[model samples]
Target chain A: MLAEMIKFEISRLLKRRTLLFWGIVLLIALFTGIIEYLGMGTPKRTVFDAFSFSTSSIMPLLLAPMAGFFTGGALVEDSRSGLLSLIFSKGVSAFEYVTSKAVTSALSQMCFIGITLVVFFVALLPFFPMGSIYIGAQHYSEAFAYNEPVAYCFLIALLFITAAVAFNGIALLTSVWVKNTFVVMAAPTLLYMGLIYVMSMDATKVSLIDPYANLALIDVYIPVSILHMVCYWAVIALITHVLAIAAFSFKKDYM
Target chain B: MNEVLQVKSLTKRVKQKVILQDVNLSVSEGEILGLIGPNGAGKTTLLKIVSGVVRASSGSVWFDKSAGIGIVPEQAALLGDMDALQNLRMLSSIRGKIGTSEIKQTLKRVGLDPDNKKAVRNYSLGMKQRLMLAQAIMEHPKLLLLDEPTNALDPLGIIDLRMLLSELAQAGTGIIIASHLLNEIERMCDRVAIISGGKILRQVNLRSTEQTPIEVTVSTAYDWDILKRWAESVHVELQKLTPNKGLPRGILKTKMAVSQVISELQSAGIAIESISHVGPNLEAVFLEYAQLEGGVYR
Candidate 1:
């Protein structure tokens, strides 16, 4: 059953126009990487900040939400297309149906994250030569020595990807719960924005659940604190999934 | 009669709209129960509830003398990404039905190219309907529920489906179909239940030879009041003309035979321009049961 569910989920995702949308975002990321390479003569703070700021904010804001909506839409597509009734009628339980969709979509997004990581590395490759050339031009041979915070940079990127995918899973819960297209798209954004607003107000208890706070903590190398935040997001995602199932089981509306 | 499906006061209200109200009906083994109603008479909603896609407000459905049930909703419900064969495999895998070979043969029976690797999205509406039929039969279900199985079907497709339903009934598989096509029900159903306003208006058995006498309409410029009274005077059962907005021209319902009454009207120097047998050919029975006032659904 899991295999069948995954097969259908992957096929559904393939139908989505998300690939083209993501392709555009990737071009922007590439353009930023090239611009940072050309401006390598600037101070180290400005150079690092240029790439860091773009990767931290732009990728998460624009690409993260699209991925979330796509992940969520994959699960709810059957209901939207009127196929749920057919499968349910044929003795397939709601539990199996929902489980298949969630697992398949999550797995697909995991694969997508892996591909995005490849693109991330390729975009940053050009900066390596540009930085070395700038050091040589300054007539300091020792400064030309290339040493990158490769492990730290890669680790932070992985962390952001994990949180983004986890947040996408929660967004998917909204899609499964609500039948309306507008609600499915808006629900996750609203939740993320609401959490951001609450965190801006106070940083005591609820700050632990905010994925952005967790992401920021990852960048600062607070591994223990980041783990704590991931746990909270995982718990919230589990709870949201349960609620999604409940809404589906008792849902009176037919898609 | 071996009861295959039993429902008691199945009710559902969506946002207090009250889609289904006290809908009670049953189908026995080896029977074709036709469900006919207006557009919003809760036909689709009722089918969804039975199929387990929608939960009823307060009702229970028992199938095959067991606690479980299987449903085939009105719209084609196969996986759009998969071909017909894959769709059948998924359905059978859920039920743990053995033998994919038998499933393949059933697909052949329905005239679907199961080996054709085209996805369901690429299939035409008629082909998809055939696949739906194939999937429903593959499980050898104890109770089969089909909604609008003939909606997109052409002439041959309709004939093929009617023959298939007849064959399934012969195999002792109880079937309930929700459809608006009264002619198909009249020709194929053993019995029918008419639902209107979320209620079951009447249950009529079509296989029975007994039929209520129809009131014949004689379209002629001559006066037929004397003929109407003459038929009534002999206790033949008749009524005077009343204008019906639905039918346009004036009409009446009576137990008088068309041949005998037409001969009587000819003797009265009435030249009959046209004669039509118009006493509710399943459609009217549905309208009366649903109490459809103006449009498709009241």
Candidate 2:
């Protein structure tokens, strides 16, 4: 039943609106190309430089909400349509259904963001040179990107994808308590920005845990370790998914 | 007939608010039990509990584990992005027992065009309601639970539903319906359980229980005394419904047949201007239990 549920949820996601996700990816890539053409960043930058710039500029701020738009309020819509009760009547447990929603929402966002990030990098290849991240010589340059340029691009893209998944989970979690469509989409972004604002006021620890810095893999004053930063967002994602599943599974009344 | 379903001491509470309390009811095979109540009366909650969509805080619902169950929620539960066929197809795929032909036939039965390409989102409320009914009845479950089944339905759609439900009952489907439409309930149900304030006030039989009292409306040309005497002789109660400003009218509450009451009134030499048995009006009974908080109902 869980497999069937995932299969059905995936099919529903593949419906027309998901094109909007790919549209955002392409739009981000095109904006990067335009900025590079205008020579905004360091001159003679590589595809790795441009892609990293794209993630830093957009992935931390705008991309999380874009992830919200992709899959956030879906459970609410299903509940409003009375589809959850209908599906429950068909013998699908609440746990299974919510798990499928979490899996589909997270993986779909991750896959879509991951693939589109790579495509954005490939699309930047012709415009920018294929030099290494080692030549950037900037204060915030990713040393992980210095040795193997492709691996660096892939790892940074994976980090951004993980961030998307976490924000998407947050959106899904909020929707369980709040039914409004707009709130569900906007909640994660607000939380991200709000937490960043609160953390920024802490002068000592702020440098080590800036959410935007962690997500884009670029530190502001001091670089947080890559493994610790990755684990931070990963834990947030796991907690959100767990809360969403528990709330839905133990819900007293589905109506 | 064997009992197909039994609910015992069912209660549901959310936080400090109680939604249902010690509500006990049952349905025999082929029986249609109507659950009638006003808003906030826990009609939908009780139906949800029976349908297994809502859990009771404390109680038990007994039924055969293998019997297929179908439910029509108060709101249409459908994939609005898909057309009717596609919605049914997706649902049917879960059980893997239904085929395309049956899906099409079910759609046709509900008066929706099986080939219509229009998405369900664009459908009118009546159409969506019809589709909801279609999905519930498609698998022919032995136990059918319907909540506000006639909502947003056109007259024709309602007539279709009446026929369909009656047919399903005839085929031995045990049904429990929660609706505000008392006339429909009186017309269809074998018994009605009146619920209010999260409790079952009374379960009145609409059919098969001959002892159910009949309310006869009467207007007599003679003084009200004549009718009162006749009512007293027959051991029936007489109460004036309207003020004596118009032609005097009174209601005779009696377990006797309408024919017998009519004959008795004639023999009493009472000039009967007009009189008729109102039969059993579930609406009046629902109001009676709803308005009077203290009584046998309490």
Candidate 3:
């Protein structure tokens, strides 16, 4: 049943026009470096620099909003379309249904971000060189000199995926109560921006909670900071999913 | 027949407004029970509770767990993005994976095209209704609940549904149909339960042809008092009709067989002008219990 549900969820997500919208966003992300090279006097000298720049700078902006827009309507559409009663009547418990939806949304966002990063890297290879890459503080750049730049790029992409999962969880939780699709789509973006603003105001207090902040430090910590950020975001995502399940289970009225 | 469903003292309170109150009913295997009521009479609520889509505030509903259940709500609950075959495939998985050929056969049984590729969103209201019926019967559930099942059906479709339901009932599947069409209920149900104000007003046994009361009207030469005494001696209720242009008239009400009633009246020496049998039709019984002043019945 779980496998079937996952298949259904994936198919449902793919069929929506939202997938097309997200596909267009990914295309835009893929061509950003070429567009930048044409506009600026000098391009990033190596593929690692271009990949890191795109993953850290542009991916978060696109990833969170895309996850938010799609997750926002994940559960709401079933209720609005009068399919909830049919689903529940067929013996699919609310918990199972919500869990399947949450997992499917998170996995989809992960794949979307993963694919975009791969495309961005491949597209930049012809234009940028594979050479000794400079990262982190000018003085500390040598401290991490032994690590491969491509590996570090992957680390940053993983961090962004973690942040996407957390955002998707928040979006799924919001969908438990908010039936309006527009509100579901806009909430995560607003929340992400709000988190960023708070982190900027007080780095000490908010950095531990802010997913994007950890992504920004990919060049500094190399491995440890990225792992810590991933764990932090994953825990938050799990909590939001548990809350979503509880809210859905306790709900007596599907309409 | 074994009892297939038992709903006891079921009550539903939605945000301080009571929707169903102390409703108790049952259906046995092979029995087709009709739930007849006016709007807001809690017929749909009862079905929802029985189907497990809505939780009841109080009371219990017990079903024969071995038998699968099927339900068709007033609004057909189908995924609009999916085509007809896909919708069945998704719903059929709940009963443990029904094959495509079987689903196609079920659709054909419900008068739907097996190969139609149109998405459910484009289906007309009647087509959607047929699809809903098709899904409900796809698993061959032992208990089926239908709410206003004929809402979008044409005359032929309605007849087809009636025949399908009869076939299911004959095959020993219990059915509880809630509908406003009393004539359909009269023809399809073995028993009819009239519900009003969240309570079942009465359960009429349509199969008990002998138990139903028959009304007898007579134009007689005897006086009203004489006819009244004869009826009283025969253990039947008698009403004296107003004399029509100086002609004596009276009516007799009894649960006896028609032949017995005729013989009793003939033995009483009452001249039978017209021996007309007025019915205890489901519609009359339904109205008697559904009206505002009808009061409660067990």
Best by lDDT: 2
Winner by TM-score: 2
TM of chain B, each: 0.82, 0.85, 0.79
lDDT, candidate 3, at A172: 89
Q: Of 2 and 3, which scores higher on TM-score?
A: 2
User: Taking the tens digit of each residue's C-alpha lDDT, what string does model 1 give over B1-298?
Assistant: 7888888899998877988999888888889999887788888888778877778889887675232344555677667767888778766765565477988898899888768999888999999889888877777777888888897888899999999889989988888888888889888798998877788878888776653544444453244555465556666644333323322222335555667657776887655555555533565556454444454333
- DockQ, 0 to 1 scale, candidate 3: 0.29
The Cα RMSD of model 1 versus the native structure comes to 6.1
- Tell me which residue pairs clash in candidate 2: none
lDDT of each residue in A1-255, candidate 1, tens digit only: 555655655655675566657755765764675565556554453333344434555555643465456665654667766677666765566776777666665566556655665565566565543332112222221122223334334444555556655656676677766667666666666777777787767645344544443244334332334345546555655676666666565656546
Predicted structure with the largest DockQ when compared to the true one: 2
Native contact fraction of candidate 2? 0.52
The candidate with the higher lDDT, 1 or 2, is 2
| Residue B37, candidate 1: C-alpha displacement in angstroms | 1.8
What's the residue-level lDDT of B51 in candidate 3?
74
Best first by DockQ, ranked:
2, 1, 3
Per-residue C-alpha lDDT of model 3 across residues A181-223, encoded as one tens digit per residue? 9888888898888878877787455556555532344444433
Residue pairs of candidate 3 with colliding backbone atoms: none
All candidates: TM-score: 0.78, 0.88, 0.81
